[model samples]
Target: MAGVRDPGALTSGQRTVMAATITASALLFSSLTSISVALPVIQRDLGISSSALHWVIVAALLPLCALAVVSGRLGDVLGRRRVFLAGILCFGAGSVVCAIAPDEVLLVAGRGIQGVGVALAVPLALANLTSALPGHRRGWAIGVLSAVTTGVSVVVPPSVAILVHFASWRWLFVAFVPVTVYVFLAGSRHIAESPRAPGASMDVRGCLFIAGGLTLLVFAFERSSDWGFTNRQTLAPLAAGLLLLVAFARAERRATDPLLDLRPLVRSGVSVPLTALAFAQCAVIVVTVYVTLYLQQVLDLGTIETGLLMLPTSVGSVLLGPVVGRLTDRGAGHHLVLGGMTLLTVALLWLAVGVDHRHGALLVPALFLLGLAVPLVYPSAGALSLGALPASARGVAASLQIEARQIGATMGLALMSALFTAVEWDERNARLADPAEHFTADEENKLDTVLTEAEKGQALLARLPPAERRKVHDAADAAFSTALNTTLIAAAGLLFLGVLLALGVFHVPRRGRRRPGP
Candidate 1:
């Protein structure tokens, strides 16, 4: 077996490989996030239902969540380079499919394929980096990876939105094709292939259970507004998904070589950091999705303006990441993690309380603070998670962390969407004069049209009389403010939970040495 290299003392060739891997990872992360700002346009062009629109943005996350552990095991059994290359191919192919997808169904299928590729790429990338680099160098490499991944999400999505303004939404997927091709070609030569461990088997059944469970759960949550939570269409899938997840847990516990080893999750070393990562990711997704909408819808900003507004997040992450990484390497993981989480919580609360139509300026500082907090939190969480495991299980551990991130993102979007929809509904209802006592049929029709028609919703107030317009504007503002606050408060709570989880799960005695490498 090839041994792990000392990251701190990497030869020039190894350093080159690390740089290439980080670049590849960054490209992939940028591709994943670049779609965020384009989502509204996609929804309009595709004529997709609200539920379908949600899936379009989040579908990639589902397979990533389900396949992560399995992909990690594949990395160990099939060789990391082979899996990594295959992932690149898959991602590129999926992008092509998305670029030409004729309808929502085809687009979603393409997105799911992309999710699989992400599942394969992300964990293998991390596993390869962790295995190739030595101690302090590993921390630094991971820091760079975290910074690039998180930073790109903040920067690239809005930039893509700017492109979408001048070009079609199809260009968003088209843009990735060249980058993917370049990364695949360049990385193939630079990265060494690790030999597969003999006698390892893929747990096909475990993969099925997890995939089915997550898909069902995600679908249920995505469609809850349309189908209603109590409807069989929603409840059945959700219940079945939960049952399958429970079955997956049972199967993993009993399997001789489980695809997803549940043992590590039970171990304090692994579980703590993983949970914190999951929660933090949830907060990030919620903030990202809503903030983009807030800029475009509430602030009436164009794509270019929105893109520029989001730049602070990326700038802050780039600045803070390396510093936090150094601190973690110097034995301050707990402090950095705690401080980052606290910053994130404060930012979310500030946004919730202070954000309004005239308060667009507040977004600048809030986003920048979040930018700073994310890099600090993510890299430390990743390093701590990987640090808890033996070398042999690093692939699985990395996959587990990625899976947590995916699940958190999916759940966060679903929850925030539900809140937004509910608030919007209430706002519409509030605008209706006492319907039980003196409502006109035209007023009821207008309200229904606002709720049902996406384009109509935007112009509803514009078409009303001046007196009525004031009422509609006030109601819309109230609704948006309420929804934004609710989501931000929820985000803040999640961040606080993340901090507590980190404190409990990631706590290592100051005098303790690193666990012996597997």
Candidate 2:
């Protein structure tokens, strides 16, 4: 291993550390979401069967979610710079594997490798920024950093479409090569090692238990879309995963070197801020998922068209981010968070009421507003989550906060899906009951499929009598629209709840000398 080169001097102080860390984190986070937009083309090129598509996308995410805490803990115990560099190396290597893979299996394997890399790097990146920057600038720095992280959600989707169109889909992975290399070389040289607890040791057993449990938990959430929640496939893994997680929590209390300091896990200070941010995150991700669907499936737009429509959100994020950060820096963190989350709540409610087949343009302002809101809430929330922590606790706090966000997004997806399914079922059954319409189980499945894939659906519907076909099509649209509406309302309610929590519960970190002696 490269001995720590004059990293303190290399950083050139906080300004360079801030710039390098933000750039590195953006690339890492963007890589996580970029694959989604390119998946269809990837599916076609790899001859990936429809059944395997989920795995292709989930491959990287699984490790990313599962290993997050473990990576953060390792950073705390060892040195942040060393662990951070190792992550860059792993991410770079994984990108190479992904770019060169010749078949579906190898591609999925490569993705998993990339996920591991992200897990290791992401938590430490923010922790470095927090520890490096001075106190007053901390919130602003974290907010701007959070803005960059959140921008990935708005930016990656549209960007991927353009890249895939002009260049091969492989270039998506290839593109990461130079960026990852630069971060590895420059970040390793510049970023300083964070303060480590003397004689701090890792809880290897606890890490294994947590890692195992998290992997299973993510698997359950990932598979729930395909395998219904009631199915044994979903229930069995979920039950076992929760049990293992419980065991991990118990282990943390007793272990000498706990993966997470158990005190914060139970404290209102940590839980409340984390809970509030998680809900807001849940709201934003659902917007990304369902809004894209409404534009494509409902408005009947193509991939490139949908991509273009979504560009305003990214533009808004880039333009508005620094302002939010500045506001937070001026000790307006709470107000900005409240205002930002309120915008999210309003945007979602607007989406619920206003979205229809003809009004794709209405989405532009709502999405821009959504993008604008993210900076307000997340950076402030991140600052709140980590600001008062001892250097070592910052890693656990950072990773745990990340894990909460991922879990929130997972839960939100499952909640929306269940609600959508229930609403769709009732609406569809009401239509199917008409005696003149005779859709068999097969025909019913085909009709549902058409909502997502219009061209193939239209061909199948042509086999039906023209009069019956139009009713069926319109009913399908109505059912989908209703389900989407209800889901948005639910998302809005969750965000509002987060707003309340942020107002009432998120207090500044308490000062203390709590680290155990060497």
Candidate 3:
């Protein structure tokens, strides 16, 4: 091998290296979905308030959003393999702490640690993958990684549901212990060292500015629903974050070796795909959260069944993984992205209409199409992201791409939350305005307020007559469906925008395209 900096000079077997990296990648991705299944169990066991329980989820997300860019850059300076190993160590340690924590506070704190580890590892793994594999194989490798994650999501929930049903939420953390340990030990041997900038000075000020800015920015987005948008608590942090980010941009332009170089983002190859992926990801995340709610709350499906009902989401990744990857390898990355976005937009619109119409069958097919479309976008986009950067800058490229998607996820969740609250308020207000419903003043007052999950559950409706209970149930479900549909429509629009951006990203002429040989 010529040197460590040469990506074409990976020293280990590709399969073994990919196994290790993808295992670490899968571990982080699985954590995102499986935890939701155990949240209710955790709340009951820890005696945490319903409203406060959101902090547990936010605690994890906050660090992932805040530290992602810095961590990626750190990998470039320090070494991707070194960062990956350290991340696994942190993640394993955090899981143990989470498993043993006696209260919600400690558990949430443990998750914050885990999130830091995740922020460190995820991008480095992809960077390593894009580096180790040949250009043609990179897309296929990304496809396999995507499929592995989808497979993990499919397996984790029902299994966690069963574990939570029979045992404690603590066991959920225990499940990952052996697997992570195996990955760490084996990965030490298989993963190769990547190109790194040992002489580049760390951008400490840039790091601080970005970390503070993104943290506050995400904080403001999360709190905006509770505190009005115009509230000082919301607006002050947001404005300050914007200013810090502006300063950060200026600092990047002036830095000797910048934390984040803005120049790579100018190319259509990089800018278009990454930007489009962000909105596409926004649609997926919002849909997943709402659909899970729809299945459990609207359809009253049990935990295991709800998990099963959502299983079709994996099929797309399985089927599209090879095709999209090959297409990307063949210089059709942008074209595939356009197709994926179109599919997702249709899926979102389908779900919106079917959900509002209260037809359960339609949701299944829509989710299937979503499964198909999502994999197409990811592999193509991830390949393009790596293509946009030099081997030394892969870490930065991967992290920035993930960070864009992270921002999209945050914004999507916030938008849906606000929309749901508003629609629920309208539902409640309608009862006060209705004369024929004949709800008493006390009943109308209670109905006029936005209801919590517990308030909407069996206890509240138990005392009502059968007819009144049925009416209440129907109204609640209808209001939820309408709100969800509105969110879906908005998500569809986001995907449509993505389609346009993706087309621009892949604007190369077919005749000029270069293809790898057998």
Candidate 4:
């Protein structure tokens, strides 16, 4: 059993080291989600179209997904500490590039560099925590890591939005540079270096296959709107991606030391948990992206106000995470997952029925429940999946888990954005066909700014005759309601699919321990 110790249990030196390391990890995770709040600002300043903006987000995610497995393999073949330090340096340099970027293309390139660094740093950080701590204490440390990384999504984004309101958006990247430097400096002294395994060669072929396949897949999703789902542009990439993935699976089977060992997925216990994890991640991203748009675009809230309205999600996750972690440690993961998914399903259904411009309050409880479900599901899924693998394969298992998450997030964003854009276009056309009885060209232009300034909208309306103003208001409200309802209904279907996958694929049998030997 682990003995009780001070919350600052490490020697002064070790405590500083741990603090620096964990802080850097938290910042990386936070920056990924926090940027959502600044999307409008980015679009305005950069003079980019919506499609181009979507590519900026996808650029960061694509490299993260493509390189995640390769980074883990390199860590195992090289040294975890050395690769981790390299990742930190690359990440800091990328931040500098992002801060000074002159155009959208350069910014996307900088973000791609940052993604490479993130792919390396994140998994190694988790693996390092496991190595530094022992037994049950390891579980607690992992819980703390999860809480920091996940909780930052709620805390950091809003704080950054406040900065955007007061200062320039470039300051967001500038703020991260100092922290990254501190982590690199402190990590040099405290973290023990893992020795490279002898005779382990990098799987170049396997890396190419997986990276090529995933790139094609994500590109297909990103361009599906413009290309049309059935057009040659879309079908060609989708088909090529599927073929390359098939080739990757075959190559992995024959490689002496594969980049991604497929053998683990063949095991019932490991496969089950991984499947559940993928679906859960997909559900979370779908809801988050749409809700953020709904709040800002449809309801006409400011960045800070939208972030504040999202507080219920952050609060629920922080409060319930530890209790769920304890339950998972006690071997109650299956039931916990079941309950969590059920709650998520209910929340999505509620949003489907109740979300609207006038009924903003109705969304709070549903968002809270959805947030509570995430922490409960995520850590438990991770623990169960890792538990099914041998101790030697822990690093690869961790990499695969993170890869699944990135893939889910990429797919969710791509799909939901397509849906929302389609709905928006349809509503825009409908309104144009029969301009609101009182709407003038001036009011129509003002409606575009409603996302940025609701007060301006009210002033514009006040200048019109009372009956005409009412007509304009009614039209805006109807459009918002129609778009929001369409998105929510889609979310409900996705969540229900997640629940079904969880029940069928992740249901562990009563008396059997997870199969060992990947």
Model 4: runs farther than 4 Å from truth?
A: 1-13, 128-144, 188-193, 356-358, 387-396, 434-484, 505-508, 511-518
Q: Candidate 4: worst 10 consecutive residues by lDDT?
A: 445-454
Against the true structure, candidate 1 reaches a TM-score of 0.82
Q: Which structure among the candidates has the greatest lDDT? A: 1
Candidate 1 regions with alpha-carbon error over 4 angstroms: 1-23, 48-52, 75-82, 125-155, 183-196, 356-358, 389-395, 433-477, 501-518
> Tens digits of per-residue lDDT for model 3 on 1-518?
45446555444577777887888898786785567656655654665533345456556666666567777678778888888888888888888989999987899888888888888887788887777777878888887887788788778777877787778778888877776787678768777777788674678998888778876776676566557678999899899989998998899889887777766677666778777777877787677666766766677665676666677776677677777778898867767778888998999999988888777788889889888888888889888777666677676677678767776665556555665545654564454243315555444434411222454244445656666766666666676677788878887887787777666546663456443221
User: Which of the predicted structures, 1 or 3, would earn the higher TM-score when compared with the native?
Assistant: 1
State candidate 4's TM-score.
0.84
Find the candidate with the highest TM-score and give its number: 4
Q: Which stretches in model 3 have alpha-carbon errors above 4 Å?
A: 1-22, 37-58, 72-82, 97-108, 124-150, 181-197, 385-396, 432-475, 502-518
Model 4 lDDT, residue 121, Cα: 83
Candidate 1: tens digits of C-alpha lDDT, residues 1-518? 36987445778756766766776677775665567676655655665544355677587888777777777678878999889878888988889999999888999888878877877886688777777776667878886787667666666766687789998888888887887787687668767889888887899999999889888887787667666788999899999999999999999899998877777787776787777777778877777766776666566677778778777667766677668778888867767778888999998887886665448887788888887887777778788777878888786787687778888888777767776666655665666553312344433333422322355444554556666655655565566567777878888988898787767655554457557485
What shift in Å separates residue 298 of candidate 4 from its native position after superposition?
2.2
Residues 1-518, candidate 4: write the lDDT tens digits.
Answer: 36866664556665565576678778876666567667666655664444445566666777777777877668778888888888888888878888998878888887777777887887677766666654546667766777777667678868876878788778888988998888898888777888888887898888788888888887787677556689899999999998998999999999887878787777655665666676667667666655765676666677788777766766766788778779988988877776776777788777766665457788888888888877777778788778778889776677778777887777666776666555654564366544444466435544533343345566666767765655555565566566667866776677677667667765546556545675
Position 517, candidate 2: lDDT: 28
The predicted structure with the larger TM-score, 1 or 4, is 4
RMSD of 1: 5.6
Task: Give the worst 10-residue stretch by lDDT in candidate 2.
Answer: 509-518
**In candidate 1, how many Å is residue 119 off?**
2.0
TM-score, prediction 2: 0.75
